[model samples]
Target: MNFYKDLEPIRRPIKDVLAEQKLFTNFPDNWHVVVADIVNSTQAVKTGKHDDVNLIAAGSLIAAINAAKPFNTEIAYFFGGDGGTVIVPDEIVNKILSGLNAHKINSLKNFSLELRVGSITIGEIIKAGHELKVAKVEIGKGYNKSVVIGNGLKYAENIIKDNYLQDKESIEHQLLTIDSSELNLEGLECRWDRIKPLTSSLEVVCLLIEAVNFKNQSTVYRDVMIKLDEIYGEADKRHPITMNRLQLLTTFLKFKKEMMVRYSKWKIGHFLKAFFETLIGRLYFKYNWKVNDLKGQEYLEQVIAFSDTLTIDGRINTIVSGTKENRLRLLEYLNQQEQKGLLIFGHFVSTESIMTCYIENRNDKHIHFLDGSNGGYTEAAKELKPKLQML
Candidate 1:
């Protein structure tokens, strides 16, 4: 008898063959999966101009990828005409949400594009992919959108996995059952959590991945702070703070402080500068107020006049001293504004002295200082708009 002839024939599982399909080549184990579909692709193709639709689709995809990257997500596969999948890490959940929110807002505002995003954990992917034939059967019944099943079929496997059943269920429910309104609420909470002093020190770094992306550090920082304040104020109005809540609040503040310091070298200064300038511009127009040496005074005056507003007793105090003196003068002006019913202030700082200003109600004094170190008055004015809106 020939020993070779007696050997049993080699058998390979069908599941193994399917898993090796070209579409699932980049699938990673132990990952978080994100599937994003462009809403109304068929309509986009039928009624929309090809160029316009392409622009919208390209923008949407770019935004999604940018948002996902900060969360440590790797792009698994993207079907050009429909959707894509991303594998995310657990640590960057907050960043992912921030990116997604920013992307969604921009897309809606610009192109009326909508995206539906679903995320799951790695363990779920493996479990779902265990029996490739069964998973394929499910896909055949219109469940190809399932990332794990797609992976098993060698289509696209970008499923998220985790050990916590409750967490998984919460995420899944959020993805499937929650509407945009519910997402907005959750998003607001997530934003608050990022900037709260309690969590600010948690080292939640956002990776900037797009040239036109909207995740400005200063803007995010300011918005989160505002939201947290809103939440805390509401909670305070309802009940005396429990120790746990107070502790959480305190932690959030600390975390925010830490994040500010850590991300100081980023474009935050530019954002701050822009915020101040925009505010000044608006106030100038609103009250017909002007700094003696400011360049845009005429244009701003026109704006005020067009809006049917006139100055109601505003003062300008120019400081000749250095930057420190300028800050003191501005601070002093703020205090004086608190005393008077009307206050409007503006100044341009030379290299030797910082140019900035503040306006306030006599009874509701608020101080605003724009550092000359950041930019000149013109540049600072451009930066100030968003900050004013925040106020």
Candidate 2:
């Protein structure tokens, strides 16, 4: 059953969403928390492989979501720039895992990136003395984001990391050859050039924050969000993507690189087809023309509204465009919180944000992923590591 789909969307502000525990629903015991991470992602990003690392991470979510589509299932998933986590029902777990396993193999073979895959049962999480609660918030006209509270997910991640480090996980994973029909990353796209802010003086910040105590997570997040708004304006004002300035970057090399994982193989012929399609896409957006009854202007608006700007899964992860002065103001509040033992945060600043997208449909079924160019969340988390050690 699509439990997530049935949950009522929280219509109030996020602060209200956090305070209303009554609105939070229990995660079904039959479902699971599946996670996959790229090993040594920091080192990989350091070598100018941020796009590669992010591509594989996005693929992890794509493969899993695409697999579920056949079964008419909707899953709640998170993209971490390095890896991702997904919540899925029991019936489709095996098939989703098959796609993820294939993704793992493809990752290693194609990019020399080692991907670690694992899963933890929701029932097992409940038994371990932690709670897993989920809430849905509408981000746009037809898209909703999953907000997970409590320490259960953090507990599962810890277990998964430990097991992976010890080489204790026994996973049966296979590769997707050209002849196989199991894995599909057809919706994944990276044609956009690095997105610059509309404001010439603004900077893109990739931020991550974690609460010290599980019990205070929701409230702490509420406060952080409120403070961010006071300093940076609303989410739309601070969103890193600017449609007016958005540009496309497509080359034969990019096409080849993406296809290596997208189709499990690349061909010069496919690039030619894509090259012509990009030409048409450019015309559509440039002239605001209607294609198949979908206007480019409307699609771009949806893109702005549906971009994954914030993700809360026992932590706060977001990308925003703001001035250096305003960023300092936001950081000031976060630093005070760190001193007061409420939360600790990490952030990286860059001239523009990197965008990777998954477009199942241009009309209404697409999501864009953003990160600061160079190294975004990965670098921010690196800055957060020593602070974590102090904890």
Candidate 3:
């Protein structure tokens, strides 16, 4: 068996490969899986702390990626609303874990959220009678999104939660002694306001969909994608991160507050610094000044490129903005298929959505994290489980 030096080069439109599931490659046995999420995200979201929850989850990814920069392959990660899943080569598993533990400490100190992170290896997964399949989806000119399939991820999640694997072997959690401030979050920014839909009647849907048979998973997901395109038109028509909708914090108090969240608590000098920076940012936004190649038409394209509006891993997950009528139409179509045992899905609706940005220099290395304002994917999964058992 031969494995490519990298997985990003074989990218295809997600819809194009749904019917050709064989294109996915088995994960290398030398790799390890790292999982992390907020421990009590639902309770936090109920208290209107979902934004913080989302930020912490996105923060964990940044920490892990920055930690894994020495690896031969880029880490493949999936961002759940309140947490995230990651895969990396075994050589850097401990390094990634250290970074995650660092993130966990920061979450506790800053947001008072407990972030649980643990690691498991691919060899154990295959030994336990499961497989991990990976594929890449081309989202933009040079960006390829990583997608994972198979029951291995879900199985790993269970192992982490239950400590099914012992401390020295299967799954292990480490508490690293390091300053959380030292964790790298270079591009993580929460500068934008909550995004409103294209219209008042429009609704935002966060969906997680899976098929009854693993072989049919991609095909069923492809149908959902087709229906969505018909209802919402092109990617630009439905993307929520538009430059026209961007607004920056101008008030001294609000800017100071944002600064505290992004960095540490403010000092007198830091407060004044934030005030001046806020004023400069206001001018930047008002005039739409260029950030190297990131301004004008190129910036809009980058926004769309970085937006996490839609994604496909083993399951089809998306944070989409559309009309109530179209949403109902989609559910009707999916439910009809569900009746035939073709697929199962969980969906949550919201009037608006939120975004977090990660920009590593503002040229092209940037991607946005998106989620429905409250209980988007998490709450929907609550309703989806019972249906899965019945089917």
lDDT of 3 by residue, 1-391 (tens): 1232366555566677665767788888878889988887888888978878888888888878778665644778888888888888777787888878777776777679888788788889889998678887777765667777677887788798777335533222334445566566655667667777767877888888887876566677778788878876666676655676655555565444444444645567756765675576667666767766455456656766778876665677787877778788888888898889888899999877787777675677788888887778777777787987785
Q: What is the model-wide C-alpha lDDT for candidate 1? A: 0.31
Cα lDDT tens digits, model 1, 32-67, are 555555555445544532223333333333444454
Each prediction's TM-score versus the true structure: 0.28, 0.95, 0.88
**Model 2 per-residue lDDT tens digits across residues 173-289:** 223232245668888888887888997998999999999888889899999999888999988888888788787776876788777888778777878877887888888899999
TM-score of 3: 0.88
Order of all candidates by lDDT, from best down to worst?
2, 3, 1
Greater-lDDT candidate between 2 and 3: 2
Best by lDDT: 2
lDDT of each: 0.31, 0.85, 0.74
> Which sections of candidate 1 miss by over 4 Å?
1-29, 68-79, 130-391
Q: Where does the lowest 10-residue lDDT sum fall in candidate 1?
A: 308-317
Better of 1 and 2 by TM-score: 2
